[model samples]
Target: EAAVTQSPRNKVAVTGGKVTLSCNQTNNHNNMYWYRQDTGHGLRLIHYSYGAGSTEKGDIPDGYKASRPSQENFSLILELATPSQTSVYFCASGETWGVYAEQFFGPGTRLTVL
Candidate 1:
């Protein structure tokens, strides 16, 4: 099974500042993703990476960016943080990029903007 880990667990950020969230996966998966969970919007993918050194913009990539420096690590960056961007974020890893691939999720990170 894939194991994913997220750092800090919680974050508080000021407007217009930069915030970074890190993720680590131990299953040697090729596909990794970053998502945010909001009340009405549900879970939305913000960024994803196919493999090391390759990051791709997801469905909602505005105000955010992603980095995949290696196979076991992925990071999500908020360059110009805003109040509207405050939400719980999650990181996931999958063995394959398909409907049937199993995805493992890390503990959610609650981010608050003020």
Candidate 2:
């Protein structure tokens, strides 16, 4: 089965502090994504990478950044954490199969900024 893991499952940050969320996948999938879930916004993509050493901005990339150093490791960095950015973050991996791709998601990382 495809598995994805995230570090620091829970976080509490100050308004101006920095926070980093790490994700690792064992699926060997080439496409990885980071998303945040909020009350009304649902799941919004923050960042994504097609493969190792490649990073791309997602639909909502304003306050977040991502890094994909290897096939299994992907990281999300919040240079300046803020209360408005606090949300449940998830990491996912997917691969093309036939005409569509299926994604496997990690548990999630709940972040709270004060």
- Which candidate has the highest TM-score of all? 2
What is the C-alpha lDDT profile of model 1 across 1-114, one tens digit per residue? Answer: 558999869999999999999999998889999999999988999999999999999999999999999999999999999999999999999866467498899998999999
Candidates' C-alpha lDDT: 0.93, 0.94
Q: Please report the TM-score between candidate 2 and the true structure.
A: 0.95
Best by lDDT: 2
lDDT of 2 by residue, 2-97 (tens): 699999899999998989999999999999999999988889999999999999999999988899999999999999998998899999999867
Model 1: colliding residue pairs:
none
Stretches > 4 Å off in candidate 1: 97-100
Clashing pairs in 2: none
TM-score of each: 0.94, 0.95
Score residue 32 of candidate 1 by CA lDDT.
Answer: 95
Model 1 shows how many backbone clashes? 0
